[model samples]
Target: MVKSFMTLAVLVLSAAGVYAQDIIQVQGTTPDLYVMHTVKKGETLYSLGRTFSLPIKDIAAENNISADKGLQLGQNIKIPLNGANFSQKADAASGGAPLYHKVEAAETLYRLSLNHNKVPLDNIRKWNNMSGDGLKKDTYVIIGYLKGGSGAVAHTPTPTPAPTPAPAPVNNTPAPAPVNNTPAPVSNNNPAPPIENNTPAPTPAPTPTPAPAETKPVASSGSSFESLYMQQTSNGKNATTEKGPGGWFKSNAAAGKYYALHNTAQRGTIIKVTNPLNGKYIYAKVLETIPQIKGNAGLIIKLSDSALEALGTNDPKFYCELSYEN
Candidate 1:
């Protein structure tokens, strides 16, 4: 079986690597900001990096997979093409040991070690404490962690946002309750300043269906998305504005230098972050979304360790400010 798997891998990689190279399926899976690649039968992380022109460690870090645990067949893992350029030095910051991979079906001690750039199976057994060939799924295995942190993130084609549905056609024939033509005497209390209506004044009946406004990216604050988002969440004064109350962030993979985790910025959007305490700032592209989990509301945004250090420190929960120009 091992011999067959190896042969299959080389053959498929040799053939498919040329034609389907770098074709990552776009998955708008929550939180992540890159294309998703489904694990295939004859593939390993190393081969995947080769096909996509990325480093294996970057792929491991992106999904936070420990080398030993191994990928499951058909598992959907994020491909951080944008995360490739990051330095791997931050792996030291995560810990001394390499991140472990959780085992999945059809994975063996031999296959697992082979997938890890051919680390010896005996060493794998020694590291994880083993006595025999038997192995279990859903367990973590170490494949050796990396030393650098700033890995390269090559840009790939971005998928277009899903098309918005057309608005229902407005009926022009029925005029709005035919406002009385007769002039009325002016009232003393000039009708309280238009009552704060946000509705776009019913799109005058003249042009029955106005073309939808073209969407352009904008630095958001005061946009309705922000207004609605801010209404539900609590924050320090001005926290919701570009200036922030950010903290040190967590990433599955080692995020490249100057990358950040924001709850609202669209993936690939670049924003500037500042360490208010020291007045140091750097621009980072938005790489992933910080989920709004109800239990963890201490910080508004999180910066990668490299980003945190770039801003000058690695305080686990440090706070900072941010600015965006779309």
Candidate 2:
């Protein structure tokens, strides 16, 4: 049997001719970010947990693999990144090993920064010793560091094939011809004699009883979070408020459950977001700090797309107010 491999940008180290395991890529959004790694010989769930500074169970859960089962050579898996395992702070260098991001096509320095938790552009340049904003394809840049890892890994570039073109659409069946159902018009040239008596007209049919109107269940307006918000602010201890431009990001959270990212609020902090224009509000839990990218500059908070929809606005950026416990 032939073995198949999943190809991606592999992370490697090239210091004094030393090569390490392959780090495939980084994916997902804040608080749910992950690093893709390829399993190698002698590697186990326990070893990966230590290398990425993640819990063994978390790695297993992220990949949906059995912790007791051994990882196959060349198999790919995702290593989850949370507050405990990943850092984009200035002091990250002192605490963790560097995690490299391989530059892809059409990627700009600004976009790269946004994708990697909005680490400072200047910091990325300094780390990579770059003087200009231009990034060449296949170049590996240091976006941030993985906390508590011991080895310093760099990237070795690999060639990627061009994407194949899509096939043209084909139509197999033809449409059927239209049919004429109207009867031929009666001729005026031959007038028929009048017949004597016609049968009694049929009794009028009874009108149909109208069906009851359907009552569709209405979607919740996210009022469930109100109880939690009230409990957090009942005593008014450590409460803070701010009003500014708000933004949103994509998330897969269940309906009526909102989440946000704020620069100052700590993770798991429940915040009350209000749209002053419409007087609509919702309570959202903070996932992490908003990435400090140029696009997010001056924004107070970023909510999930569902939360924004519940607030009754489709504008990508809108004016809003926030209240939360410090």
Candidate 3:
């Protein structure tokens, strides 16, 4: 009866549709809470815990695994919930504090916000007062929870102005003279011969020419294709098939071939597709909304033939747990 009750409770939690958090607990005497979460592809245990609320020590104790180790796909680990209350006021207020993080090359502020859910991108912007898009590599930003309540600052330091330079000394007196200025007599005594003055040349006659009119060529490049679009179809008075964000559209490509149409789905999503059989994973970009079609609860992803082959899938459609890459 106890086993049945426990199974029923787990089923209820699963059916409630609340996404499972990174936590797992042992069913034994004095068992501690563990950060239990399903291992997604490309996820390391250390990274998963760090991203969420679990500490490295807690994660190690819960899983009976070493924190210095890595994680395998589909592995279930325990996560303690002691400090897991994210929606609480204290958690939000204490979101930013003094924590050190090594800035990765090409990492941006927007990416950082996504990586650390509690740290608001706007707060980072206001704290740094960054004038441009985001942060660059090797730059430092506060990583831990923040202290003090939000309000006006008590005082702000003003920068000191630079001092003026002293003026250079001027000359007191003017100096000395020239050696000599000699003048010679003119030799115009042999200029008795008369000189001939040539007549001035006539101005060239004006040439007549027709004025050219400006010409504007018609545009050859087509308009931008919709990044997210929908389509429907019917056949012989009955709906047989429908697909879009899938057809071909004339594009401005230099090859003169029509562009392969895709729904764009806002922007292409970076997804990690895993093959459960061998524990292999391939990263792919889901560029269409076909998976989001009505009546399809499962994530149905379509890929180019080459991309599909690379991922080792021969089917027309496949399912995957998608994690967007910033």
Q: Which candidate number maximizes TM-score?
A: 2
The lDDT for every candidate, in the order shown, is 0.51, 0.69, 0.37
lDDT of candidate 3 over 1-326, digit per residue (tens): 99999999998777444332211111211122222356766767556555554567767776799877888887876544333523213234345222223356765543454445434444554444444334445445543332222211111111111111111222322222221222222345435444322322332332232323322211111122111111111211221222322111111222211112123333333333344333434443333344344534333344334434434445545543322222
List TM-score per model, in order: 0.28, 0.41, 0.22
Candidate with top lDDT is 2
Ranked by lDDT, top first: 2, 1, 3
Flag the better candidate by lDDT, 2 or 3.
2
Model 1: per-residue lDDT, tens digit, 203-322? 566574455353222222223323333333332232334654667543322223355567777655556566767766666655556647753476667665566666776666767666
Is candidate 2 or 3 superior in TM-score?
2
RMSD of 1: 20.3
